[model samples]
Target: MSTTAPRQATTPTSTGWSLGDIAVRRVDEIELPRQTGPWLLPDATKEVLDEASWLRPDFADADVPRLASHGFAVTAGGLRIVVDTGIGNGKTRANPAWHGLDTDFLARLAAAGFPPESVDLVITTHLHTDHVGWNTRLAGEDWVPTFSDARYLTSRTEWDHWAAADLDEARRQMFRDSVHPVRDAGQYDRVDVPEQGREVAPGVFLVPAPGHTPGQVAVELRGSDRRALITGDSIHHPVQLSHPHVHSCVDLDPAQAVRTRARLLDTLADTDTLLLGTHFPRPTAGTVRRENGRYRLLAEHGSEIAATAA
Candidate 1:
């Protein structure tokens, strides 16, 4: 794979990108400025952000930095796979902003032409509150699988970790509502990928990218000539592209997170593999490049092609 020239920075709409035969689309749930607390990233100080000037306007403002929580709808191998469901509606949440959300998430998905039932599989990169909230929905007095016909795929390590974790009530409540219901419905599949990568679907694979969560994995898509990696919280913001060592506060293992981030950035730098950040603001997809002996992201417009040959 080869590198591509940077394209003019364009605003990221709810548009999708085509990777040869596969189509990847973004199903937006929420996009807001990054919370002004160390709860997200303690190292993301104004001084640190000031150095990454590219993050302004779209990612970080003078007052508030932006972060997005959305899901990707991957259509490949004749399958409709929904990766990482965002926070669902009408559920109790510890965070005030996430509680009782009434957004038209399902409506937006349908508007994007992907109804819940039409989804063949739902892959949770990790079992986090925001990532797995849409796995179930409030139905009458109990929660039920939102994608009634889709099979749920979660890493075995993630499943076991949450299952046996000594979590607080709030986190336990999240599992009871979002994950348990799917497991009870017999639709949940525990994927035990012992190696770094494993083919989960035709031309699509799961690459182990742990640290954000014990079992966090990045979804890789290989089309006829192009490839893309859906980075699931491995690198939350573009700022990490410049400073891979600055880990998020929520990272389960800070040191390991740093290692994972550095490895991924080094491996993909100056390569054709498109990097699709799960929490990055507008123009969320890009390719890594080395500049001034450091790494940066060359943001890509959906229609832009790789400048170099594979």
Candidate 2:
């Protein structure tokens, strides 16, 4: 991996913003693999994890920030509608794969043209550390909201689950660094989707895709005839695109996660939709096409690893 990341993907439009009024910018940060060290696949996940073993070597190096393409939509006048912030610097989660980590997810936000003050809405699909890291920054002795003027929106169920205090050390640590500070600063607002999954923004809505987290959700974006869905940790890798039955090691309810995945896959297959994933490698935005009940990632431009190599 290169020590430096390539520039954020770009396109030209004299309008001076990206993709018309909805400008998306990638924030640099990484969410370490939750599982590391010698670990056998859970009997249930064997087939799913093994299905794409040949591609695992492509992500072996830790030098390049494995950013989940932390990004958001920007208005023509520069108002920021942040989707999710990436892992923060100096967080202390107990999972060995995520321990001993540090990165500048905020600086990248600035580089992407979103000053801390420009953010309007900070939306999170769920309450995982990676989905909410930039929610707060280390300020002197306490963690505080990185965006002073922004409202941090989260699912009501997710907020309640992590704050329950019965979670193990790793989960407790995740909550401490990724969530509590935003609430303490009076910046966090828990939004209830009584229907379980519902729209949270004009063009964005939450789909109750549970099981990964008790309240795991997917954000859907619609504009004119175009539509996109952000599958937050609901499906971790593109490999899962073809094998929706594979369970994420972090899901609160593995069985539920599978059902959500199946539902999502069904939706993708049945509709002409694009997807933006929190962890679907680089250029995370793309279209999904179904072939014999299987799916493949149809990148917006093309594959990155191949272009970078050439």
Candidate 3:
């Protein structure tokens, strides 16, 4: 079988949002196969998606919701932070679409001006296979931490839950190669986040965002002029904004996920804070508004800062 990666579908322009002194850039990884939406969020049916016309052209195609895997690179307070790592270049994954793939993820990151070694912190919104895959890279026969100088952070609750769960071989392999290597290198730290949230860096906070995962936390980037929230799978797609009850197929607690989504939308409704979804496709940042007693994203594209080649 051929082992070449498919040509990247996204344009090479760098898209980023400005938060006063802070800059948040989108590092393209791979636009997920169209099947990802149906498989991951089965409840977001075509009929349901049709209700939100604003979702078309950008967030979703005609019938199916489009999703992409990427990370948010933030430069704030003299600290460089990455919100979540996308599926790594080469890793064994149970999901056929995510397994043993090769892509120029690091090159894209560098083009956006965040070389791995230059990153100061990597905030893993939660410990999921795709979110944590780039935490390590192959070193001879073993995996090693990708960010040698950076400290990895996750909620203490998230770590402890996964630590005790009976992980399958795929999950175990993920930790063995990606998650554990960072910890083994003494570069991993778990923070305790309360109801309000915990500030990891200047103006960056980790707010309690449970239900998706017991320990899931949404990142809040508060700036002097405006604020943005980095949703860590708490809100997977734009359809969820319209129908907050539409839950992901893998949600640990569907009911709680609904509640969390409701609370998050309520907080962001008719506000200036930009909502950045961890799995949202292109034009990934937007503002929330209450429309006809429901929520919808007013899509926002960032200013182009640099050019890259796929």
Candidate 4:
């Protein structure tokens, strides 16, 4: 395990997961650095009325779901796969939003009964600070791949864009400190999920839901009676579910991001599919349903009730 023992379950409001008909507990949260930058997106200027009406928050004490965030260890294709690694400790960054700080990602992974070496495959839905923070861990003078025995999977296109030297410092360093070490170790496998959507494991497949980033993907997991998606960043801040026009200023292609978000929102709406979002109020999983023309997030089980009770 990453470390022994588990931290206290600080936050109580979290969703749950059951895969292969086996219930799994949330691995708890880790304290990672985040930028409570501007309350809302700068490009998206709004007032109190807009903030309240729109699913936005004021720049107050924005405590992103630390304990709320969870990592699910599931049995897929006869392999124990760890979908995403939350923020890791001892990572250095420049932005005040993300700087020098340590998180209990490994400890939480351990808390969830997984050793760093236990993960057979580590699938990165996308390349973002928090999403890939634990890809490499600080070891002595240099960073080392977090999971020594696991094959780290990332899209070939994503690896290229961030690794480019001409990109901004934040983007460059994210690739250097967080991603390159895994590549350097030769443990990295550039999975070019062109069109057919390669099935990394029996029921766990990578759906090419690009746009937020060039090669970003939404992971699809289907078992006997259940199916779900690990959405990387296709939708951040659940408000987008209802207001698809609200694109994060950082989006590589805001228009394309909008199109992709719309398509995904439609695809999962009113279905029994659960969405494990990277930033959706933790346990980070939910279901999407259409009301009038927009959608809202419902707890995984809540959706089941709504579906059957209807």
Q: What is the C-alpha lDDT of each candidate?
A: 0.80, 0.61, 0.87, 0.63
What value of lDDT does candidate 3 attain over all alpha carbons?
0.87
Q: What does candidate 4's lDDT look like per residue over 2-29, in tens digits?
A: 1222233453322346655433334444
TM-score against native, each model: 0.91, 0.77, 0.95, 0.80
In model 4, what lDDT does residue 183 have?
A: 86
Q: What are the per-residue Cα lDDT tens digits for candidate 3 across 1-310?
A: 1132333555544689888877788888888887788878888889998899899999999889988888998988988888899889689887877888788888878888788888899999999988998999998988999889999999999999999999999899899988999999999999999998999999999998988889999999998889999998999998999999989888888898899999999999999999998889879989999989899999998888753222
Query: Candidate 1: lDDT of 97?
Result: 66
- Measured on C-alpha atoms, candidate 1 has an lDDT of 0.80
Cα-based lDDT at residue 186, candidate 4: 92
Expressed as tens digits, the lDDT of each residue in 163-278 for candidate 1 is: 88899988988989999999999999999876668888888898888899999888999988789999998998888887788788789998888898898899899998889988
Rank ordering of all candidates by lDDT, starting from the highest: 3, 1, 4, 2
TM-score of 2: 0.77
Per-residue lDDT over 225-302 for candidate 2, one digit per residue giving the tens place of the 0 to 100 score = 566677887876666666666566567788888888877877876465767767755556566777655776666632
Candidate 2 RMSD to the correct structure: 6.8
Off by over 4 Å in 2: 1-20, 31-79, 302-310
Q: Which is the leading candidate under TM-score?
A: 3
Model 1, residue 56: C-alpha shift (Å): 2.2
TM-score of 3: 0.95
